[model samples]
Target: MSLRFAEEIILLALDDQSGKLRPLPDRALELAVAGGLLMELAFANRIDTDQKQLTILDRSPTGDTVLDSVLQTLPEGDTSTIRQAISRVAADAPDFKDKILKSLVEKGILNREEHRFFFVLKERRYPMVDDREEKEVISRIRDVVIDGAIPDPKDVVLICLMNACDLSSAVFSDDELEQHSDRINQVARMDFIGQALAKAIAEIQEAILETISYMGM
Candidate 1:
């Protein structure tokens, strides 16, 4: 397999073993192995043996629990040899190793510690709610309302009815509705205005639905 793909598989395998989702170190041997350069090194006396305890030792003994976890995640069979080869190459090829480390860190798959790289599998990801499209959608809705483009009463009512039906079936539970009775009542009071706005929203919604139907949404 290709060195890059092998490196990726090693990371994935380690993560699976360790139950942590962190990037692997940018060892030269790792790059070589990933690039398929390490088979020769593995055969030569230059590399140490592969094993779990040895793998842990190979990584710079820096108390990196996350890194340790990932190393431990590797399967029992190929773990030791791969780990030793990675350690030896990384130790030997500082410049190339550093480059790989930087790439992993920059990609946010690895963290930095005392100039060393650590992996994190469970990286945080923000929800799509903060996307540009969501922002623009909200902005447009506000602009339309503020600009006094009130929708027709029938459309407004239909929109509110749709929301109420959807909420009843898909979102809010009966217990939640009862618990938030005051807020529900306040929202209920806005049904009249919502109905008015719904007319225009309904047209927009219908147009979108029609477009989606044709476009295979």
Candidate 2:
């Protein structure tokens, strides 16, 4: 099962794809948490019609350039109905709560305890981590993508080599994949990233020395 909180944490950092390696968006992550809470509340039938309507607009738009572009491309709809829905939700906070509560209860993922409620899955619950910690992880991933400091060069070379030779072997195991990934992050920083990638490709089966083939190629 997916960890709802973990998904929320990575939303914002996914926005900038300019980097060779992209990071998740922080705001998107927060929006996901909020959305999960909303989902929890809705399943509990604590949401009102109005609250649900408002929530649609509040959703995180990160990693959604295509969606956003599509939305903008859509022709305008009638505004009065949308406005009326907003007004109705604003008028009844209790109804909103009821709707959310009912929805959550219906989903069987939330349970009421006295007045308060709790999510069923432990993974859904998370304490907020500070920006510093988040930034550190992001930075490390970026460094790996840009610098080519992957812990194991052999695995990276093998993948590229396989591609060059048009050979289909057993897939890289998860651990080997992660090592190649680490190198990808580091390689993102290299001026000769393209060349390095080429070298990786050239290192596949060859009559000449592998390293020399990569160099000459």
For candidate 2, write residues 105-197 as lDDT tens digits.
Answer: 334433333322384442222122233433443344334444544523323322232222222112234564565654543343232222232
Q: Which segments of candidate 1 are over 4 A away from where they belong? A: 1-171, 174-190
- Predicted candidate 1 versus true structure: per-residue lDDT over 75-100, tens digit per residue: 44433544333344434433443453
TM for every model, in the order presented, reads 0.19, 0.19
Per-prediction RMSD in angstroms?
A: 25.6, 21.6
Task: Output candidate 2 Cα RMSD.
Answer: 21.6
* Candidate achieving the largest TM-score: 1
> Top model by lDDT, which number?
1
lDDT score for candidate 2 against the true structure: 0.31
